[model samples]
Target: MEVEGLSVVYKRARDRAGAPDAAAVRDVSFSLPAGQTLALVGESGSGKSSVAMAILSYLPAGARREARVLRLGPHDLLAAGEGDLRRLRGRRIAAVYQNPGMALNPSLSIGRQVAEILEVHLSLPRAEALRETERLLGEVQIREPRAVMDLFAHQISGGMQQRVSIAMAMALEPALIVLDEPTTALDVTVQRQTMDLLADLQRRRGTSYLLITHDIHLASVHAHEIAVMRAGEIVETGTYAQLRDDARHPYTRQLLGSVLAKDPRPEARPGAPAILKVEGLEHGFSKAKRGRPAVEDVSLVIKAGETLGLVGESGSGKTTIGKLICGIHDRQAGAIELNGRALPTQFDRRGPSDRGAIRMVFQSPDATLNPAHTIGAILRRALAIAGAGDPKAEAAALMERVRLPAALESRRPAELSGGQKQRVAIARAFASSPRLVVLDEPTSALDASVQKEILALLVELQKERTVGYLLITHDLDVVAEMAHHVAVLKAGRIVETGATRRILSAPEHGYTRELLASRLVPPAATAPARPGAARDAPWSAVSQLA
Candidate 1:
C-alpha cells in the first residue's frame, strides 16, 4: 500500500461566507509494506484517524477526499468505485476500531456477529461460516470459543469483547488491517496480551498493519516505521531508534520528553496523619455468577496530603473499592472512617457534613455531568448541598483551582473538550472542600499532553489543600508518579502493598512483576533493528493518556 499527498476536508452542514475550510489530513504520504506495520502517532484531532478512514474509503458523508496517489496493491483507493470499494473492504482490507463496546452489536450473539462477517465477505453457508467463526475465535486466543460464541457482548469481559472484534476483522484474512487505537481502553496486562496476539497473527499470516494511535511508546515497539503527525501533516517519519535518539521536530521532542519523565513531584511525605481508613472491607454483587466477592478483605489508608494508589486489572475490584468508599456502593462488612469518624455504609444515611467531607471524581465525566446544565450550575449545586455560602463565589474559586477559565462556567458540558470537561468534574468535587477525594481513573480518557496538565493540577491542588486522594486505576506508572503508597488488587483482594517506589522497583508478587513487565516502552538493549520489528515497551504510556 502506498499513499502520497493525501488530503481530506469535511464540508460543513451550514457554511457561511468567509468561513475557512480546513482539511483534516493534508498532503500526507507513507507506504505500508506487506507483512509490516506503520504507526501514525499524534494527539487527538491530529488527523491520524482521518488518513486511515480515507485509505479504507470509510470517510463519513460530507467529507471530500483528494490524493495525488493512494494505492493498495495494484488498485487506486482514491479512484475505486463504491461497489468495488465495498467488495475490497472486508475481502482485501479490514479495520479494527477502538471501543469494542460501541463497535459490537449488543443484541446479537458474538457467534452470529463473527459468522456474519464470514458469510457476507466470503459468501459461505451458515454452517460453514459458524465453523469458521469458531476457528477465528480460537485463533485470537478466546477460551472455549464454542461457549463464548453463544454469549452476548455484555455477557463477556472487556478484553474478551476486544478479541471478538479482532476476530471479526480477521474473518476474511485480508491483506491489510487498519487498527485504530485497538487497545486504548484495555488494562496494561490485557493490552500487552492483545498486542502479542496481533504480532503472532501478523508473523504467521503476513498481514500488513496500519496502527493509528496517540501512544508514542506503543508505536515505538510495534511499528516498523513511525510517522509523527501534527495538524494533519507528517512532521517526521523514521525507525523508532532514529526518532527516539534524535527527534528533529519540537512536537516530537515534547512527546518523547513527556513519555520519559515519570513523577515530577517528590515521593513520600513523612508523618502525615491518616485522613481515610478502611478496615475489613468486603462486598459482593448478589447477581455475580462467579461467586467471587467484588471486594474482599481490602484494608488501606489514605494519609493527608498523600495519595493511595489502587492498581488492578479490569474486574479486579479497583473501581468497586473506590465506589464503596465514596458511598456509591454499600459495604457488606467493613468500616469506612473519615478523620476518626465512621461513615455510613449508604450515602443517604450520612448527614450533610459527613457527605461533604468525602467526595468522588468519576472515571467518565460525561456520565457524572449533565449535558443540560452549565458548569457553574453543577458547581453551584454541589456547593448548595454542602451548605456553602455564596454559590457564585465558590464556583469561581473552584474553577480557578482547576485552572479553567472563569468564563467557561456559562458553557454546558458539550461545549468543553475532554480535558476541560474533566477539569469541571474536578472542580465540582472540590466544591465541598472535601478532606478526601476518590479519583477514579481521572486521567484515563484524556490525551497525553492534557493528562500531564491535569496531573500537574492535581499535585498542585494537593500541595495547597493537603487533600488526600484515593487514586483507583490500572495504570502503574500513574501510581508511581502520583501515589505515595500503592496497593495492588486482584480478585477483590490485596496482592501487594507498600511504598510506591519499593513496589515498583522490586515487586514481591508475581502478578505485580507481570504488570510492570507489560508496560509499553521497549528497552534500549534488545530493541528490534528490522523494518518489521516486533517488541514490547516498559509499562508506561500506552496511548493518549501518558
Candidate 2:
C-alpha cells in the first residue's frame, strides 16, 4: 500500500458568504511494505487519521480528497467506483478504531457479529460462518471461544472486545489493517498483551498495518518505521533509533524530551491534614450472588494539596472507589470522613455545602457537560448552585484558571476540542471551590501533549487552592508523576500501598511489579532514570490548534 501527495479539505459552515476551509491533511506521503508496520505519530487532528481514511476511501462526507497516487496492492483506491470500494473495504482492506465498544454491536451476540462479516463478504453458509467465527476468536488467543461467542459485546472485558474487533478485521485475511489508537482505552497489561498479539498476527498472516496514534513510545516499540506529523504534514520519518538519537526537527526533539519526564512541582509538605479518609470500605452490586466484593475492605487517605492515585487494570474497582468517595455509590460497609466528620453514603443525603466541597470531574466531559448548554451557561449553573456572589465573574475567573479563552464561553461542548472540553469540565469542578476533587482518568483519552497541559493545570490548581485529588487511572507513569502516594488494586482489593516513588522504583508486591513491567517503555531506554525517556509527542503551539 502506498500514498503520495495526499490532501483533504473540508468546507466549514458559512455564517458569512466566505468562510475559511479546514485542511485536515495536506501533501502527506508514505508507503507500507507488505507485512510491515508504519506508524503515524502526531497529536489529535494532525492528519494521521485523515491519511488513513484517504487510503481506505472512508473520508467524511463533503470532504474533498486529492492525491497524486493512492494504491492498495493492485487496486487504485482513488479511481475505484463506490461499488468496488464497498466490495474491497471489508474483504481486502479493513479498519479497527480506537474504541471497540463503538464499533461492536452491543445488542448482537459476539458470534453473530463476527459471523456476519464472513456471511456478507465471503457468502459463507450460516453454519460455516459460525465455525469460522469460533476459529477466528481462538486464533486471537481468546479462551473458551464458544462461550464467549454467545455473549454480548458488553459482557466481555474491554481487552476481549478489542481482540474481537481485531478478529473481525482479520476475518477475511485482509492485506492491510488500519489500527487507530487501538490500545489507548486498555490497561497497561492488556495493552502490552494486545500489542504482542498484533505482532504475532502480523508475523503469521503477513499483514501490513497502519498504526495511527499520538503515542510516540508505542510507535517506537511497535512499528518498523515511524513518521512524525505536525500541522497536517510529515516533518520527520525514520527508525526509532535514528529519530531518537538525533531528531532533526525541533518538534520531534520536543516529543522525545517529554517522555517519562518527572513532575516539575515541589514536594508536598509533611504532615498535611487528611482532607478525605475511607476506612474498611466494602461494596458490591448484589448481596445474594456475590463471590467477592466490588470494593473489598479498601481504606485510603488523601491529604490537603496531595493526590492519591488509584492504579489498576479494568474491573479493578478504581472507578468504584472514586465514586464511593464522591458519594456517587453507596458503601455497604465502610466509614467515609471528610474534614474529620462522617459523611453520608448517598449524595442525596449530603447537604449542598457537603456536595459542593467534593465535586467530581468525570472522564467523559461530553456525558457530564450538557451539549445543549453553552460553556458560560454550564459554569453559571455551577456557580448558582454554589451560591457564588457573582456568577458571571466567577465563571470567567474559572475559565481563566483553566487557561481557556474567554470567548469559549459562548460555544457549546460540541464546538470545543477534547482538551478544551476537559478544561471546561475542570473549570466547572473548580466552580464550587471544592476541598477535594475526584478526577477519574482525566487525561487518559487525551493526547500526550494535552495530557501534560492538563496535568500541569491540575498541579497549579492544587498549589493555589490546596485541593486534594483522588486520581483514578491505569497509566502508571501518570501515577508516578502526579500522585503523592500510590495504591495497587486488583479483584476489588488493595494489593499494595506506598509512596509513589518507592512503589514505582521498587514495588514489593508481585502484582505491582507486573503493572510496572507492563508499562510502554521504549526499548532504547533500558531504564528511564529521569523523565522524558519514553515521552509522547512534545507540546506544540500547532497541537493546541486542534
Candidate 3:
C-alpha cells in the first residue's frame, strides 16, 4: 500500500447555512512504506488525527473532506464505493484508537468480539474463530487468555483492553494499521510494552504504521520516519534524530525546549507534620452484586507544603485512590486522617470542617466543570461552602491567583480553554485555603507553555502558605516539577517510593524504568494542525461531542 501527494480535508458544517468553512486537514502528502511506520507527531488538532481519520474513511459525522489521491497499492481509495471500502476496511486496513474501552462493545465478551471480527473479515466458522481469537489474545500478551476472552470489556483493565484492540486489528493481518495515541492512557511500563509489541509486529508481518501522537519520545522510539505538522500542513519531515539534532522551526523548538526539566524545589525548607494520612486504604464499586477492590491496602503520608506524586497507568487505581481521598467517592475501608484527625470517608457524610480542610481538584477539568456554570459561580461556590471571605472579594482574589481575568467569572465554564479551566479548578480548590489539595493530572490537559505557567503558580502557592498536594498523574515530567516525595503505583500496589529525584532519575523497578523510557522528553516534536491555524476553525453543526 502506498500514498502519493495525498491531500484530505473537511468542513464541519457543510449541511447548515451561515456555517463557517473549516478545513480540518489540508495538503498533507506522505507515503506509507510496506513495513515501516511513518509517525505524525504534533500537538492536539495538528491534523495528525485528521490524517488517520481520513485514511480510516471515518471523518467526523459531517465534514467535507477532499483528497487529491488516496491509494492503496494499485487501488484508488477515494474512488472506492461504499461496499468496496467496507470489504477493504477490516481485511486490508484496521485502526487501533487511543481509548480501546470506548471502541469495544461493552456487552460482548472479548472472545466474542474478536471472533466476530474474524468471522466477518475471514469468513471462518464460529468454533474456528474462537480458537483463533484465543491465539490472537495470547499474541498480544494477555495473561490467562481463556479468562480474558470470557470477560466483557468493562471487566478488563485498560492496558489489557488496548492489547485486545491491537489483537483485533492484527487478527485479519491487514497491510496497514493506524495507531492513534495507542499508549496515551497507560502507565510508562504498559506504554513501553505496547510500543515494543507494535514494533515487533511490524518486523514480522511487514505491516505499515501511521502513528499519531504528541509524545515525541514515543515517536522517536517507534517510528522510522516522522512528519511534523502544524495547522494543516507539514512543517518538517525527517528522522527523529534529524529533527532533534538541528530542528529549524520555532514551534518545533518550543516543543523541544518546553520539557520543564525536573529538580526538587531548591528552596526546600521542611515544616509541619503529616498533612494527610490514610491507613489500609481500600475501595471498590458494587452494592447490588459481588465486587472486587479497585484499590486495596493503600497507605501514604504527605507533609505540609510537599507534593506526594502518585504515578500509575489508567485503571491502575491511582484516580480511584485520589477520589477516595477527595470525598468524591466513599471509602469502603481504611482510615483517612487530616492534620492527625480522622475524617469521614463519604463526601456528604464529611462535616463542614472536613470540606474546608481537605479539597480536591479533579483530573478532567472539562468534565469536572459545568458548561453552564460561570467561572464566578465555580469559585464562589467554594467561598460560600467554606464561608471563607466576602463572596465577591474571594471570587476576585481567586481569579487573580489563577492569573485569569476577574470578569471571566460571568462567562460559563465552556468559554474557557483547557488550560484556563485547570486554573479555575486550582483557584476553586484553594478558595478556602485548604490544608491539603488533591491535584489529579493538574497539567496533563494544558499546552507546554501553559503547563510551565501552572507549575510556576504551584511553586508560588507552596511558598505563600502551608499547603500539601496529592498529585495523581501519569506524566513523569510533572512529577519531577512539583513532587517532593513520589510513590509509584501499579496494579493497586505501590511498587516503589522515595524522594522525587531518586525515583524519577534513577528508578529501581523494571516498571519504573519502562515509564522513564516511554517518558523521555524530546527537545522538539512535530506541529499540529499546521502552524498558525486559527484556534476557532470554521464551525459545522456536527462538531465532536465530548
TM-score of each: 0.92, 0.91, 0.86
Give lDDT tens digits, candidate 1, residues 1-546.
888788899875564556767689888887777888888988888999999999998889889899888899988887789999989987889988999999999999999999998888788999999999999999999989999999999999889989998898888889999999999899999999998899889999989899998888788778777888888888887777877788788998887766634442356478988989999999988864577788998899889998889999998999888888878898999899999989999988998877888889888899999999999999999898888889989888889878899889899998798899999998888888889999999988776777778877888888899999989988876776688888999889999998887888889999999999987765373566332554342111111211
Overall lDDT per candidate, in order of appearance: 0.85, 0.87, 0.78
Report, for all candidates in order, the number of backbone clashes: 6, 8, 19
Top model by lDDT, which number? Answer: 2
Error of 1 at 170 (Å): 1.7
By summed lDDT, the worst window of 10 consecutive residues in model 2 runs over: 537-546
Q: Residue 182, candidate 1: how far off, in angstroms?
A: 0.4
344-374: candidate 2 lDDT, tens digit per residue: 9999999999999998888889899999999
Residue ranges of candidate 3 with Cα displaced over 4 Å: 1-19, 260-267, 280-297, 313-316, 332-334, 349-353, 388-397, 405-410, 445-453, 490-496, 505-546
Number of residue pairs clashing in candidate 1, backbone atoms closer than 3 angstroms, sequence gap of 3 or more or interchain: 6
Clash count for candidate 3 is 19
Q: Comparing 1 and 2 by lDDT, which wins? A: 2
